[model samples]
Target: MAGILAWFWNERFWLPHNVTWADLQSTEEAAFPQAEDLYLAFPLAFCIFMIRLLFERFIAKPCALGLKVQANGPQKAQPNAILEKVFTAITKQPDEKRLEGLSKQLDWDVRSIQRWFRQRRNQEKPSTLTKFCESMWRFTFYLYIFTYGVRFLKKAPWLWNTRQCWNGYPYQDFGIMFTHHIVTVTLITFSYVTNLTRVGTLTLCLHDAADVVLEAAKMANYCKCQKLSDLLFLTFAIVFIVSRLGIYPLWILNTTLFELYEALGNFPALWVFNILLVILQILHCFWSYLIIKAAYKAIAKGKAGKWNPLHVAKDDRSDIESSSDEEETVPRSKAPHSSISTNGTGGANGTNGYLTGGTCSEEH
Candidate 1:
C-alpha cells in the first residue's frame, strides 16, 4: 500500500519548486521516500498487476465486447485435480528440473507434462479483446502523461535555449525531470514484466529501448544538455515508428523468412541472442500483419486498421498464437512467411512446425 501510494503521489512531495539533489538527501529538508530509494518498485508493480486484473475484469473486457472483439476458443483446460493443484501451486514458468520432478510424481511422461503446462498457459493467456482493452489503458495513460509533461515544461526558460541543458554539466538533476525519469522507467518495466508473450518479446524490448532513450534524453535535457537531448528524442521517435510499423512487418518479415536458412547452416553454433532476436522478429511480424493488412484495406477500400480488429471481430485471430484466432481475414496469397505463427503452428507461415506455412501467402 505504501509503495502503491508512492508510485502515484511520491513525486509531488519529493520534487517541488527549484528542488535540488541535496534537498532530497537532507533529512532537515523536504519529506517523502528518501532520494535514491528504489525498494518501492516491488509493491508498486504488484499493485499495478492487481489494478490490471480489476481493469480487465470491469473495464477492458466490457469495452472489448462493445468493440465486438470476442476471443473464441476452449475456455479452460480440464486437467486432473492433481494437475490443477500443482499448476496453481507452482510458478507459471518452471525450470526443467522441477518439471521433471513433477512429471515423475504425477506418473506422467515429460512430453505429457509439457503439453499440460502449455495448455494451462494457453488458458491463462488473455483474450484478444482483453489485450485490446489493456492497450487502450496504456494508450490513455501514456497520452495523458506525455501531454502533461510537455505542457508543464514547454514554456520553461530552459526549453527555449539549448545552453540551459548543459549549463552545469552532468552532475545536475532537476527534481521534476528526475522524478519523471524514475516513474517512466518503472511504468515501462511494469508493462514488460506483466505481459506474457513468446513472439512479442522483441517488440517489448524495442519499446523499452525507445522509451528509455526518450526519457533519459529528457533527463539530460533537464540536466542542461539540450543538444544531445534533441538528438536522442528524434532518434527515439524514428526508431519507435520503424520498429512498430516498418521493420516489424517489412524488414522483420523478410528477415525471418530468409535468415532461418542462414541460421541453420550453423545451427550447432548459433548465437543465443541472435536466435532470440530472430524469434522476436517473427512475433513482431505476426502482430503487425494486422496493421499492415489494415493499411492495405484502407488503401484499397478507403478505411481500415484504425480500430478494425478490436471492433470488426471477423478475423478469427489467435490471441495466443495469432494463427488460431483468425478473428479477421485478409486475402490469402503466396508470399514469404516465417516459421512461427500466431499459434506456434507452421501452417500460417509454412506447412510444418517452424516452417513457413504458406510463406506469408495469406493473412487474417
Candidate 2:
C-alpha cells in the first residue's frame, strides 16, 4: 500500500522532468502552493457559507423586499398523508396511471390530485423571494471576484501576452491562483495542485465575469422584471458564448494544448492538465448551446417588447391555470422549454449549468 502511494505521488509523474517537489517549495522570497495549504479551504468555506446565510438574511432579503419581489409561490397543498408519502418515497411527479391509482386511493378527483401534486412540488421548490436572495448573493460575490481578478491580473504579464504563461515552464514567482460548485471546486483543486496558477486564475476570472450577468438575470426573473430579465439573459448568452466558446478555445485551449507542447514538450502531468482543460472546454460548448437556446426563446417570446407590470397579476393567474389544467391540448412543441446551465457561472452557467441534466434553471 505504501509503495503504491509512493509510486502514485511520484514527482516525475506530476512535475516536468528535472523538476522536484523541493524546487516548488515556498521560500522567504516566494510562496508556492503546498498540499497542506488546502486545509485552509475547509474553514474558509464554512465561514463563507455562514456569511452567505447572513447576507441572504440581512442584505439580500431586504433588497428583494424593497424591490417588491413576491415572497411566496402558489398556495400550499392541503394535508394528504398518502400523497405526501408517495411524493417523498416514490416520485414528485406521478404518471397518468399513478395519478389514477392515487386518485382512487384518496377518493379524490383526478384534477384535485394533479393540483395537489403541483402545489406539493411548488411547496418543495424555493420561493421567488428566496431565489432572488440567493441570486443576489451570488451576483454580489461574482461581481466582486471579477473586479478583484481584473485588478490582480493587471499586474500579471500573461494577462497581456499568452506566451508569457509558459515563460519559466511552471517554476516561477508565486503569483496567480484561485469557486464553490463541484466542477469549479474540481478545476481549482487540480490547477492549484499542479501549480498552473496563471491559467487557473484566467479561467476563474472568465467564469466570474459570466456569473455576474447570469445571477443578475436570475434575480431579475425572480423579481418579475420580465423585460430586464430577458435582456440580461440575452446579454449573458452573448458573454458566455464569446468567453467560453470563442475566447476560451482560441486563448486558453490553444495556449495549454498547443503552445505548451511547443514551449515545454510533452510530459505526463502536462497531458493530464491538458485533458482536464479539454473536458472543461467540452462543458463550455455544452453550456453555450443551452444559453443560446434560452436566448432564442426569449427573442421569440417578445418579452422585451410586451412587458407591463400591471398585467403581471393576470398573466400569472393564466400561467398557473394553464399549468394546472391536465386535459389541455397544447402541443408539446409549443410548451415552454426551460434550459438550465449547470456550472452556475456563464450568463447561466454552473454543475448546475451544462451537463446532460444541469441544475441551473433558465425559466422562461
Candidate 3:
C-alpha cells in the first residue's frame, strides 16, 4: 500500500528539478511540527483568562470610559406607555407592516412610528452585564464543546481510524452518546441566537460546553480590543484537536460508517447515511488541510507572535445546516438573555447576536 501510494504521488507530483525520493523524505521529516504536550493547555487557558481580566479592567473599560461610550447606562430609558408599546412592538419585529400597525393603532405617521421605534430599539438594548454574560457564556460553551467532544468518544474504537468502529457487529448503543449530540447542537443554536436579547430561561442543560465561551470572550473584543482573537484561538485549539479531530471520527464517523451496517445491512437508507457520513469525513479532512495551511502561513508571517496554536474549526456546517430543518425561522419566544451588541461603541463581534467571529472561523 505504501509503495503504491508513493509511486502514485511521485507520478502525480512530478517533482520539481526531478528531486530524488530520499531528499523528499528528509525534507518532510525536517519540516514536520514537533508535538506539544496538550495538557499544558489547561494552565495556558487560565493564563489567557487572567490576561482578559486585566485587559478588560485596564484597557477595554478604561478606553470605553474615557471615550464615554456608555449609552443610556443600566437604568432603563423611560418612554410614555403608548410610545413604549409601539417601540417594543417594532423591536420585536422591525418591519414596515408592524410599524404601520403601530402607526394605525397610535394614529401616528409611518415616519413618526419608525423614528420612535428606532430610538426605543436602541434604548431598550440590554445592559453591558447582559452583553458580558452573553459573551462569557459563549466563551465557556466553545471550551465545553471542545472538552465534551474529547470525553465520551475518546474511549471508543474509532478515534484511531474509521475502520475500527465497524470491526464488530451489533455493538451496544450508549444512551449518553445519542442524547448528547442532539441536545448539544440544540443548545448551541439556541444559545447563539438567544444571547442577542438577554439571558431568558432554561429548562435543561448540557453537562459540558467552548465555542460558547470563546464567543463571549471575542464579543468582549468588540470594544476595539481585537487581540482577543489570537488568545481565544490559542486557548481553544488544544481541546478542539483532542475532541474534534481526535474522538469525533472514531466515535461518530465509525458508527455511521461501519457499525450501523451490522444492524441495517446495505439497505438504501443505510447507504444514504453511509455516503453522507463519508462525504462529511472528506470535508473534515479538507478543512483540516486548510487549517494546516493557515497554521503554516501564521508561522511564515510574523502575526503568530511567540505562540502557534494549530486551529481546528469545530465549525461543522453539516451539523449546523441540519439544525436549520429543526429550528424555526424566527423563534416563537425571545431567547435566553446574554445580551448581544452590534454597536460599534458596544463591540466588534456578531451580526445581531450571531458573531461572525473571525476570518478563520468563518472560512469553515
Tens digits of lDDT, candidate 2, 1-364: 9999889778878777777778778889778887676777777788889999999999999999999988766567778788888889865456657755765565655545555665665565566677678779988988988998899898999988877887885567775455332223665676676677787777778777778887887777767776787687667777888998888888888888887778767778888888888998897877676656655664688546333211211223213321424343221221122112111221212211112211122321
What does candidate 1's lDDT look like per residue over 201-261, in tens digits? 3233334434444444333332334456445544654555576557555543343344433
TM-score of 3: 0.38
TM-score of 1: 0.38
Off by over 4 Å in 3: 1-78, 88-115, 173-219, 222-224, 230-264, 271-364
Quote the lDDT for 344 in model 3: 16
Q: Which window of 10 residues has the lowest lDDT sum in candidate 3?
A: 196-205
- Deviation from truth (RMSD, Å), model 1: 18.4
Q: How does model 2 fare in lDDT?
A: 0.66
Can you write out model 3's per-residue Cα lDDT over 1-364, one digit (the tens) per residue? 9999677545223222223334323242242111122244456677757766775666555544554443233223335597676555544324545644554565544433333433344444454433443445445544555566557556654445544433432222322332222222333333222110011011111113334534533443433343665565444444344445655566655555566555334434345444554665576567656655655665587565322221243432201111111222221222232112212111223222222222222222
Each prediction's whole-model lDDT (CA)? 0.42, 0.66, 0.39
Best by lDDT: 2
Q: Candidate 1 or 3, higher lDDT?
A: 1
RMSD of 2: 10.2
